[model samples]
Target chain A: MKTILSVENLIKKYKNFKAVDDLSFDVKKGEILGLLGPNGSGKSTTINCILSLLKFESGKITIFGCEMRPDAYDIKKDIGVVFQEVAVFEELNVIDNIDYFCGLYIKDKEYRKKCIDDAIKLVGLEDFKKFYPKQLSGGLLRRLNIACGIAHKPKLVFLDEPTVAVDPQSRNNILDGIKKLRDNGATIIYTTHYMEEVEILCDRVIIIDKGKIIASGTGDELKELSKIEEKVTVEIDSLDEKILEEIKQFKNVDEATYNNGILFITYKKGKNNLSSLIDYLKKVDVHYDKIYSERPTLNDVFLYLTGKELRD
Target chain B: MFLHNLKYSLKTLFKNKMLIFWTYAFPLILGTFFYLAFSNIENSEKLDIIDIAIVDNEEFNNSIALKESFRNLSGENEQEQLFNIKYVDLAEAKTLLENDEIAGYLLVEDSPKVIVKTSGINETILKYVTEEIIQNEDVLTNIIEEKLNSTVIDGSIEEFIQNVREDAISMLDTSSLQIRDITSKKLSYTMIEFYTLIAMTALYGGIIGMTAINQNLANMSNNGKRIAVSPTNRIKIIFSSLLSSFIVQIIGLFILFMYTVFALKVDYGNNFPMIILLSLTGSLAGLSLGLAVGTIFKINENLKTGIIIAFTMLGSFLSGMMGITMKYIIDTNAPIVNKLNPVNMITDGFYSLYYYTTYNRFYFNIISLLIFSLIMIILSVLALRRQKYDSI
Candidate 1:
């Protein structure tokens, strides 16, 4: 895939604080690039610098093989940005807000209206065409914000935390709308703190911490960074400390903890770790309610690499 | 693109309840209070003929010179009467003064004395005239003696008294004093307050200008950031937004003119076209100030609002909104301040229409307002030239 956007040695500072420190990355064509980070990370700042909304100390940003400057309207025309904070006008209804933003890019009235309708449908706001932003709920307002940004149907779109503080249904709706944008031959740069969203929606993920890219790859590739292959949880009424030690002694059991009717264990790159633990529990006469095993999640991988939870 | 931005910008601005209130409702309410406060003020300016009395004492009755001087000055010769004197005793004279039927009374003492109950323009004029007569007593007496000797014997020598009165008037001219003194063709100082009120209404359009510019600046709002990142021209966005703000301002200006003219019955003179020109120019000055304020700093909406109000009220204050004398004082002390202040420019423009016979002063104010607006807009455009900012 061709590179649609590229940033080299991007450094943005605020007073003495380095908001983006020597950041370099590329967004490939038609790919959903997830910029995953915790709160206060440089995700939003990076996007702002790329959009030329903030002045960076030193950087080279290129879009569509052309250098991006503040007055580079030719490059800006094919780009869309949805800020982390909602940017829709409180006075305008849903349709007007969408039309206003869409008109900035598409001048033809009929085509613009169609694009606005498509954006509204994509965000699942068909029934809320006339509702003002203040009248909408937090989730609906978030959807409206997204609709305003992408209504122009630019070739490249930047969605910064579009699903923050939304319900599961709305989050799913937003993620699906993003996917539709990608399917409609648009490249997406999605930034969020939600790891599950990155895992579910990102084709290529770049995890940032403290204004630096700590890891960048596919979800599976990044998960492989963790040595622990599997995680198991067993539900039991109670377990003795010595019996938990015996379960730890089982092959490939790296860590084990038993608390209040549930037993948790992690395995380091070994097969049949769950069954082996179940066999040890049976031999110890430890009656369990249930047992399950699953792969290490992105948070677990992040914890392994950074010594902190992904959310922290 | 300009029309599209302008259309939606109008919708957005007009829909905002707070903006409409500041730009229209608040000014109209304040204007109503202004009209009520100053509605009767012009009526109080007309000076009426003063009614006075002469004390009928032995000194006044026995002296032919004093009697003839008083009689001739009191319209005995059919000249424009300065006073209508009643020959009353001392008690009756005091009674008339106490009852407010007379402005004051004159006593024929060794060195003639004038007395009044309270101080006013009429009272001051009477006292000044009495002093003038005392200073020129010898000239008047000689003139009266000359008239008396030359005229033939007649019971009523009115022409002789008329000649004496004419000689006295040459020594002390007091022909044009009235209750409501309008010496300069309907040019009343009370109208300055209304002119400044109109000026204030025009400049309050600054709030509208600020609101319009706030919608498109990157540091001011998220809508601004969105517009900043779009492919459209930033200058065009700002121009159209200001254009919309101007339309709203004109609507507000029109309504205020109607309310002041038709409702409050303010006589704004016959220079209707010049009035419109000054109003539109003043509104532009206000709008440009808003544009400058919105772009020159990264301040929040509330702070920007405070700035516009502070500057506006300060300008209004110096332009004589509180009192017409303040504008006179400022013009006397610091002519450049009113020259720079847009509010003063507007009020001064209206004043030229009321006070001056020519349009020269009015044209100067209009040009000053336009230049002020142009400077603000140029500064705003310079500030807005940078597509990116150090901080949002």
Candidate 2:
């Protein structure tokens, strides 16, 4: 696949603190690239550098085979950015706001009108064409913000935590609209802290922490990197600490814990770990209601790679 | 692209009711208050009549012409009267003068003289009256001698004397001597308050300029961040936004000007076109000042607004917006400050148009305003040239 965006050795500093430190990544054409990180992990700073909206101490960035600079209008014309903070004019109504932003790129009156209408429909803001920003609810306002950014139908789009404070329904609609944009041949760089969103939408995921990329791969590939092979959860009526300790001694069992009449077990490269646990439970005469085993998920991989430290 | 930006900018700025109130309504309201407070002062000055005393001795009784002239001067024609005369003995006249019951006392004889404790407007009038009486008596005596010597046989001496007395009374009529010189084109001192009000209105354009800068700079607002990332050139954005703000401010100024001129009857000179042009330039200066301050200061919006208000008010205060004497005080103490202050330049421009027959001062003020505006705009553009921000 052709590379749409490439960053090499990006370094952004604020006095004594480094916001984006030697970051390097690339996004291919016609694919959704997920940048997953906690707050202040430099996801926004890195995106800003790529768009040339921020100056870096030392770095190189290329978009569509051309060096990215502040005045690179040709490259910028095909790029769209939806900021984490909604940035629509409060004085303008929904339709006018979208049309004004769309006019920034598409100057043709008729064509710009069509693009604006399409964006409005895509964001499900058709009923709010004449509503000012202050008159709209938070969810509607978020949708309007997204429509304003993408109304020009640019070939490349950047969505920076677009669903940060949106309701579930609006979040779902925004995600679906983003997918439609991708399917319509627009390359997307999606940044978020939610792993589920990355799993659902991203083609490739890059997990970052402390201004550095900790891991980058497909979902299954990232899961494979984790030491946990499976997680077995068993619900029981009663369990003893001695049996839990014995379960921990199993050859494939990595860790076991019992709480509130439920037994949780993690395995390391084990086959049929659930059956083995059930046999042990029967032998121990521990009555259980139910048991299930699941493969290691992307969340586990993210935790394993970035650690379980609390981040703000 | 410029037209598009301009169109949207106009729409956005007009919708801000608070901006509209400050730029247009506040000035009109304040102007009305100034009108109410000052309209009566000029009228009161016009109606005042000076009081004087005359000694009623044998000489005063002998001068029937002076007594008749005094009666005619103190007639029922209120607009014609220059003095209210009181007849008394020499001792009583001196007592009245000493007690401040009258401005001065007249000692009547062949040559009348005025005696007063102090000199003032009333005392000056008394002196002028006394001199005029003496001069008229000399002229009448000369005319009588010339008629008797020439043997002009038209009428009797009594009839001739009566004709001369009537002519002398008509010539000495104090009614024609205007107390306040209303015919001269000196502007009312109260008009200074109105001029300063207009100056303040023009400077309110700064708020709109500040808003434009806030909407364009990346660190100022979320809207600024979005626009900063767009493909549009930053200069285009700044130019279009500033132009739109100027247009809005000019419209507000025109409304205030019309209200003051027609509704409140405030004189802003007869050169309508030049007045409008000066207002436009003044608005430009105010707007540029705001843009420069907004770009240079990395503070919050409310704090920036406060700074703009404080700065504009200081300029107005120095220019004598609060009182007419303040401008005179500043001009006497520190004339250079008036030349440097933008608000003073604006008010002075209007003042020159009204009071001066030549455009020298007016053009000087306009040029100073233009130069100040250009410097501010250049500084703002330089400050806003950075496309990338250290933080947003």
Chain A TM-score values for every predicted structure, listed in order = 0.97, 0.94
Per-residue alpha-carbon lDDT of candidate 1 for residues A1-312, written as tens digits (9 for 90 to 100): 899999999999999999899999999999999998888889999998998889999989999999888789999889988888899888899999999999988889999999999999999999999999989999999999999999888999999999889998999899899989999999999998888999898998998888999988999999888889999999999888888877788778789897778799999975988777778777878888888999988888778878888788
RMSD of 2: 12.3
* TM-scores, each model vs. reference: 0.81, 0.80
- In model 1, what is the error at residue A156, expressed in angstroms? 1.1
Tens digit of per-residue lDDT, candidate 1, span B1-392 = 89989999999889989888877887778778877776666467443456899898887765554565466556544334557788888899999999999989989877567779986656755664554345346545675676687674654577776766566555334422111212223435567777887888788788888888888988889899999998888889888998999999999889888987888777787888888888888898888888888888687888988898888889989988877657755765688898899999998788767644557667888888889989998898789878788888
lDDT of 2: 0.82
Error in Å for residue B279 of model 1: 0.9
The DockQ score of candidate 2 comes to: 0.46
Candidate 1 ranges beyond 4 A from true positions: A235-237, A258-262, A287-290, B40-190, B328-336
- Give me the candidate number with maximum lDDT: 1
Worst 10 residues of 2 chain B by lDDT: B175-184
TM-score of chain B of 2: 0.66
Q: Candidate 2 at residue A301, lDDT? A: 84
Worst 10 residues of 1 chain B by lDDT: B175-184
